[model samples]
Target chain A: MAKILDGKEVAAALKDELVAEVDRLRKQGITPGLCLVMAGSRPDSQSYINSAVKRCSSIGIDCRVKKLPEDVTQGDFLKIIDDLNTDPKINGIMVMRPLPQYISENTIKYKISPEKDVDCLNPINVSKVISGDDDGFAPCTPAAVIEILDYYGIKVEGKRTVVIGRSMVVGRPLAMMLLARNATVTICHTRTRNLAEETKKGEILIAAAGKAKMVTKDMVSNGAVVIDVGINFDESGKMCGDVDFDSVCPIASSITPVPGGVGAVTSTVLAKHVIEALKLQKGIY
Target chain B: MAKILDGKEVAAALKDELVAEVDRLRKQGITPGLCLVMAGSRPDSQSYINSAVKRCSSIGIDCRVKKLPEDVTQGDFLKIIDDLNTDPKINGIMVMRPLPQYISENTIKYKISPEKDVDCLNPINVSKVISGDDDGFAPCTPAAVIEILDYYGIKVEGKRTVVIGRSMVVGRPLAMMLLARNATVTICHTRTRNLAEETKKGEILIAAAGKAKMVTKDMVSNGAVVIDVGINFDESGKMCGDVDFDSVCPIASSITPVPGGVGAVTSTVLAKHVIEALKLQKGIY
Candidate 1:
């Protein structure tokens, strides 16, 4: 069996560090806060919100969830985002996925101020990431990927990294982040032909395809490190990732499991970002 | 010898098309105008300006040149850009290269309005490009690279493209552009170990390392299409590129020359952007 790049263990460690940081900031009368806006009610959204709120409470960070109806107007949503932007107590702002069909992500993205956009969904932050400017914070998922690598003491510098999927949220941003760390990064997608030929080249393989078992054992090189970012369901209705974990584990040097890997890290990262956003708000590095 | 991509011929064809477009726009009382801001007496800067000016004159677009002293203050230079932004006649703003060591490119890039940023140097345009929003123009060299590929009727969808170098000016932007086109792009740099191993993976190889003959025959696969973006000096003081032309020419299915490959398309692309910026200002696609 390969060494598990344990996100549960790592996230616990990060949360402890954030706890100390939040406590120290509390001494200066600073209250770290996060504002989450969820448009429409979905069970998945509620579950994520519940978990996030629990995590925030554990870290002493205030979590505010604002739920809007499905038929909310675009202007109203923008107004709400603007309100959070100017809210001194709100250090970070995150809008849950699948916002109403009528409300475009671009419109919401542009409205979020870069500083409060802890999710880094804003175009300005995206450009800063591409330009390799350290001033901007990376989107939490990609940031978590880097943190996971760092925790495992993996050699990112000069390593061949292949990123599956090219969504703005994961693959594209992650490629830029990996490149900034001096990794030779390649971005592949659904449109990519001969996927196995490309995946075999990665010393570090990242799968974010959002499809179950997209990367099989043959797709990876021997002892290659795999980071699975996929969250999907198998035909048996069980949660799985893009990588065939059972098959890949024996061939891979290290691999992250779907439930125990990235999912474990994300909430902790969001909490850490809230603290960081607080520090920035208080003019502390 | 390899079949030359013949960028000079391609560029002439593109320029001729732009000339006709300029005439059509003029009839609608929308004359494309470019504002060239040169902050020093650098020979390279002077030569580039002269070339752009002559090209614009031939194509029926009005070109304005603002030659500021090398010792000009940042405030004064920004003021000149502001003036151009407000000037209805000036549709495109271009800050010529190496703006006196004292004046940073960031300052100039920020001062130019996004609407008039023909060079696509501003953060706004940069962000737009990364976000896949068609509102802004792309950087000239990167845009030209795409144009050349399109002119040759080469399909980028699902192809393996290796971009050697990650300079914000070319490599990074070009990589994003290629990704948007559905090409699996790998970006490499000096820190990249086993550089040749990475280069051999490319169906389309873009050499932008700015080093003469850095990419040798061994680094390239047989029949790979090579686009050399490097303009550097050889040991014998000859203008060359990252790709070792003599040895790799026989191996490449199609290749571009140092002077005529990417460089040939750059200025014409800039001219095209100027026109495009003008159209944008008039609220026309």
Candidate 2:
């Protein structure tokens, strides 16, 4: 059996550290606060919100969920973001995706000040990620990938890593982050002419293509580290990953499973970013 | 002999178009203006400033040069930036890099207002480039590469593109731009395990890596579109590029020469970005 890179174990360890940090901050008269701005009623968003809130409470961090109605106007939404920006106590702000049909993400991204943008969804923070600078926070999902690698002792430096996706949130930023860590990263997408040929080169392959079972054994090399960032429904209606775990485990050295893998570590990273954001904003770092 | 992508010709043609636009803006009582901020006495920046000034004059755009003393304090330098940022008449602001030893790039990058950041140096503008949104402007060198390719009718969509280098100014932004154009972009850098092995996969190869003559004939595939963004000096004290001109040119279907290639197109693109910034600031875009 291949080494299942366990996210549950890593996340638990990370939570313990966060608890200590949260307590330390509380002693210094700082209470890290995260505001979750959710628009419309995405069932998935609600579940995600619940999980995030739970994680915040576990770490002794304050969590505020701002639920905006689906019919909220653009002006009203901007006003909400403005209030959050001025609220000195708020350390981090994360607006959930798949926002109301009328509100464009492009316009909304600027409203959330980069200082409070823990998710790194704000464009300035996005640019900072590309620059390999200290000012901006890394997006939570991509940061989770790094956390998982650090926990597993996987060497990203000088590795032939292939990222399967070109998303700004996952694939693009992750590639830059890996490069900052000294990895030679390649970004492959749906338009890639030879997906398997390209992916076979990866010593460390990250699948964020959002396609379930898309990566079979043939696509992976022997004993390569694989991370499944995709959350998809299989034919049996079960949540599976981009990599077919059963098929790939035999061929891979180590891999992250669907639910308990990257998904487990993402929210914890969000909390970590909140803490980091708080420190930077408060001139603690 | 490989077809040399003539950047000088493309730039000249672009100049003619910009002239017409500048006149149009003038008729509307908005003179398209660009303020070049040069700190210290770097010879390279001086020459670049001269060439940029000449380019602006030829295109009928207003160009102002703000030359600061090498020993100027960080506060004084930032004050100059603030003046330019608020100056409604100034359409674009170009800060010559390699600022004095004391000033940080991160601090200066933010000092330039995003609205007038013609080079896309501002973090918000940088993020906007990644977002592929309506507001942000693309940096000049990357924009030059695209312009050269578009002018030559080389297809980027669905192409296997390889970029050597990961500088925030060129390689990183170029990859995002290519990705936005639907290219399967891979970013390789100093730590890449097998640099040539990865670069060989590109149908379109871009050399922004600063190493002189690093890319040889073997690194490129036959008849590939090559764009070189390197400007270095050879042993003879003559200017050269990352790609070995004599060696790689024969194998490449199209390639840009160091002196007349990306360099010629860069300043024109910078001017074009200024016009864009002007339009955006005036609510004309």
Candidate 3:
């Protein structure tokens, strides 16, 4: 049986480290504050916002949720963002995505200041991440994945890694991070032919396709380290991962379970980015 | 035998099209000046600079070569770039690489104005290319490859592309561009295991690995389109590409020869970006 790479444990340790960093900021008369901008009452975004608030409390940071009406005009929304951008207390701002259908996402993304853009909604940070710019913050989900690998003492250099997604949040940035660490990363997406053939080559396989048990036993290489970043429900409406957890776990050397894996790890990393964003404001970088 | 993808013909045609665009800019009283920054006496950089100057003249744009001493301080170099960034007449700027060992490349990159960063030595533009930002310029070498594919009517959508390098100038950016066009692009670098196995899967194989004749006949799949971007010298001091052209030519459907391939195409695209940069200055974009 493969060993479980527990993200919850790693996240806790990471938070403990960040807590001290936050404490330092508190003593310096600067509170690391995250302004969560929510536009509509989407349950998906609400769930994430709720988790973010809890993390803020645990880490001794401030969380202020600014709720906007679903029917808010583009001008008003942009004006609100402009206010937050200049707010001395707000160190970082995250606009909860899939805003009101009428509000342009691009306009809102452009409106946020790059220094306060903790989640990488701005185009410049998104591009900077892959270009390997140190100033840019890593997208939280991808940063969480890296944290997991480091926690497990997995060597990334010269390894063959296969990332099974092309998402802005996870796969692409994660691949860039891996490539920066000298791993040969192959990014396979929905259009990739012979998925099994591709996955079989990976020493590190990252399943982030958001499908239920899409990666089966036969697709994995022996002793492969599998990281499941997918969150979905199986046929019985049970929460599951993109990996066929039960079957692939026996074959893989190291594996991360769906609920207790990357999902559990992201918020802490998100909070860490907020703290880093705060430091940026202080000109520490 | 594979058909030769004539980059010289494509580049010539592309320049012809740009001439009209440049004419319009001239009519608007914007000459689209390019400032080519040369530090020290690197023969390789000088050779590239000569071509860039020639292309500027042919396209009716202004070219100025600013030479700096090999031992120039970091402050002086950055000041020069700062001056170029604000120079109203200078539309685009490209700094020849391999400055004095003491000077940091990244510093010079960040100092250049993004509007005049036509070569994309700057990290932000490199990232913007993949981030779906239409405002940023694609690095000339990668843009030239795309232009060649477009000239030949080779569709990128849904094609299986394998790029054999991870350099900022070509492989990484080209993969992003191809992915943006709906192609499933796999980037294989030096650390890739079973290199032949990976390359064989691609419908379009791009050889950018700088090693001379690194991609052999066995590495390519039959009827695949091969793009050789590697510029290297063979045992006899003759210029050669990564692909073993003679052996792979029969197996591939179409191929680009070395020296005359990407090299012939890059300068013209570089000139086009200057015109585009000028347009941005005029608020035409």
Leading candidate by lDDT: 2
lDDT of 3 by residue, B28-80 (tens): 77788999998899988999999889987899989999999999889989999
Model 2 misplacement above 4 A: none
How well does candidate 3 match the true structure in TM-score terms? 0.89
Query: Reference contacts recovered by each candidate, as fractions?
Result: 0.89, 0.80, 0.46
DockQ of 2: 0.74
What does candidate 3's lDDT look like per residue over A80-197, in tens digits?
9999999999988988887898899877876899899998888668767876777888778898999999998998887888999888878878888888887878788888777788
Q: Interface RMSDs of all predictions?
A: 0.9, 1.3, 2.4
Across B4-92, the per-residue lDDT of candidate 2 in tens digits comes to: 99999889888888889999988988788899998899999999999999998788778999998888888998999999999987989
iRMS, candidate 2, in Å: value is 1.3
What is candidate 3's DockQ?
Answer: 0.47
Q: Which lDDT value does model 3 have at B1?
A: 99
Clash pairs, candidate 2, are: none
**DockQ for each model:** 0.85, 0.74, 0.47
**CA lDDT, candidate 1, residue B255:** 94
Q: What is the lDDT of residue B120 in candidate 3?
A: 84
What is the Cα-based TM-score of model 2? 0.96
